[model samples]
Target: MPVQTRVVYQVNPSMVNALKTIREQAYNASRGVINQRVRIQTVDGQIYEGVVVNVDRRHVYLTVPAMQGYGRQWDEDLILTLVLYELLVITLLYI
Candidate 1:
């Protein structure tokens, strides 16, 4: 017998709207509900997946559970370059 493997791809933004909508409908919504799953590709074309824990109109903040090369959570100073997913939606913070 031979081993077999298959791969599946998902467009990360597909869930962004839903997450935003949920946040909008919640009474206790805070800046944190902006969290969403995003797919990021590095300069070398490697892919990574994690939560977009924060977002602004121009950029996204990712809490990546994994990092390549270092193979673990990176130090605070080194995290800036590893993720590159653009924010797909904008939500206002509760007043």
Candidate 2:
């Protein structure tokens, strides 16, 4: 039997900086884009896809995608960076 290999994805630092800008602009613009779909790239190279639930000057709250056979779950991971509209926004949240 052949074993299947899972490829791990890594997020770039420059991308993180761009995402931060969108986040800030979104905050400043007070746009309804809040709670929008977001892909977060952690410093650990873990890629997380979730929704932006809440945001502040310090951190961003994302309701991580649901797990198998689990009640409503969520995680507050640091926003190292993001790619919104093809723009990369890197935040210090990862650090």
Give the candidate number with the greatest TM-score.
2
Winning model by lDDT: 2
Candidate 2 residues 39-94, lDDT tens each?
A: 55644565666666665554555565445434644354433223233223323222
Backbone steric clashes in candidate 2, count:
11
What RMSD does each model have against the real structure? 13.0, 13.1
List runs of model 1 lying over 4 Å from the truth.
1-33, 42-46, 66-95
In candidate 1, what are the lDDT values of residues 1-93, reduced to their tens digit? 999977687658889887555534331322454455545554465654555565443344556553446555554422233322322233432
Separately for all candidates shown, the number of backbone clashes (residues 3 or more apart, or on different chains) is 0, 11
Quantify how close model 1 is to the true structure by its C-alpha RMSD in Å: 13.0
Candidate 1: lDDT over CA atoms?
0.46
Pull out the clashing pairs in model 1. none
